[model samples]
Target: MAIKNVVVAGGSGALGTPIVNELVKSGFNVTVLSREGSTTTQPAGTTVKHVDYKSVDSLKAAIAGQDAVVSVLGSFAIPEQIPLAQAAFAPGSTIKRFIPSEFGVNTRKTPGSAIGKILGAKTQLVDFLTEEANKNPNFKWTGISNGHFFDWGLSRGLFGLDREKRTAKIYDSGNERFQASNLPFVAKAVSAVLQKADTPDDKTANQYFEIASFTPTQNEVLAAAEELTGGDKWTVNRVSSAEVQKVAEDKLSKGDYSVFVDLLSVWQYADGAGHAPNLADPALGNNILGLGHQDVKESVAAWLKE
Candidate 1:
């Protein structure tokens, strides 16, 4: 079935905004489901519905008539998805596709050592949606796994990098290659998936559609950063991902829920280790999704300036 009308939950977010913009650009009728009292602005030609996220009836009303539903809600808000999905698959609903917030690693199949705890809600939601889709023929689900957010993550210090100081806690010799995607490319990939929603050979449905901007090792990323901002200005400290993981585990075991330690635990999978099993795959969704590559140097350079 052709997906024309799309509803996006959390369309006001950093990632959701771009996806909403791309959907509008792709000629889909866009609607954003925002909680009442939200003040975020949406793109032109987009309709914003302020509704109660807790109520299934409210969510159903917001989702009604949408051909596709995209949930870009934050990780913590994953429980909200259960009701949202139920409302989408409600009787007489027009929703055909559901894209949950599986925007990072293939957490369902390869939940990395540290990120697994973080991915609990998402993993459970995936199973819930998969079973829901199986029960409803008219409903299908697509999950986009782009590994880590490269440009945005770096800018936000998600990569253990202090962007301003040009200092990094390099993981495992800085040579472990893993998949990553730039923010805009992620939006483009989502647009591409919606565009192809009509085709019978759609590889995205009920599957984890994985894509990447470039798979680079920590050392490669450091080289790029150094080239952008001379080596003398940058400092690097090498540490084993396993060690970081051990520390993180110990902290968490002792009931320390510090964000830093949690992030370090998640980095264990990304840090040049074999923890992430699917990072080495070459047959990404880029070709089938008609996505062109963004120059890594250019992206990194731009991000550094930000």
Candidate 2:
């Protein structure tokens, strides 16, 4: 029904921490579950529980009285969510809503490519949660598929512009428009979804919601960077999206795990244009969620200034 007591797994992580803060600020009773041996401290005004992640019983006990379970596990730790999901929707559980850890691109529309392999676990979890929700009338799930984390990309040299190196690798003509959201916007989206969970006009139940702060092309991002840095021309390199996907696939086949950057480029430029699967969706849930909009130029200027 109305999601009040909420449990967040991996609440100390980069994206997870912000989501926790927003949920707390929104006045949702928050509980963070860390691994049994984790030394990280939980944020103030929330309860913390250390439990064995591998045990469904331990997870069930920690989340016994919660109304919703929001998971923020990273890619590597995604498999651990299976037990958590099982615990949340277990027979006689109080949990009504389950928000899985899918804070990136809409993998439901993901093409058959390297990025799909990287997101296989996420897709599996979505399917599992959907099936579980279908079986239980009271249980529902929501997936927030924000295109890309914009702020993180800017600071971490994603989107192919390395300000430090004054170098750029613009994807195919660099004119593809794809969805991207700042980290805090994503957190706000989550809080908004939870706030409307029990409303009469609830649109979040058993659905995958897509949101983005801004949808900008690679060239536009470069332009913003150039404008911010007084129009310094970046050393540019161009690569085909297909070739980048092939490279990432080849590297992954060889056990190299550093292919995510290439895969990100491939996802953005998958159609040889800026056609991210999420952007192609007919219905974007930004308006439905009451989330704030962010402009790319302002975001770039602020992040670059930092």
Q: After superposition, how far is residue 25 of candidate 1 from its true place, in Å?
A: 1.1
Candidate with best lDDT: 2
Per-residue alpha-carbon lDDT of model 2 for 119-203, expressed as tens digits?
8889999999989888898989999988889998888877777877777888787877787989899989888888888678898
Residues 1-306 of candidate 1 have per-residue lDDT tens digits of 378999999898888988998888888999999999988888889999998878899998888778999999987688898889888889988888899988877776545455566567888889999998889877888888887778778777777677777788776666667678887899999888887875777877787777888767777777887888865546887676666667777776676657443453345334445433343445567766878566677877888888
Q: How much lDDT does candidate 2 score?
A: 0.85
lDDT of each: 0.78, 0.85
Q: Could you estimate the TM-score for every candidate? A: 0.91, 0.94
Clashes of 1: 2
The 10 consecutive residues of candidate 1 with the worst lDDT sum are: 268-277
RMSD of each: 2.5, 1.9
Off by over 4 Å in 2: 270-274, 277-282
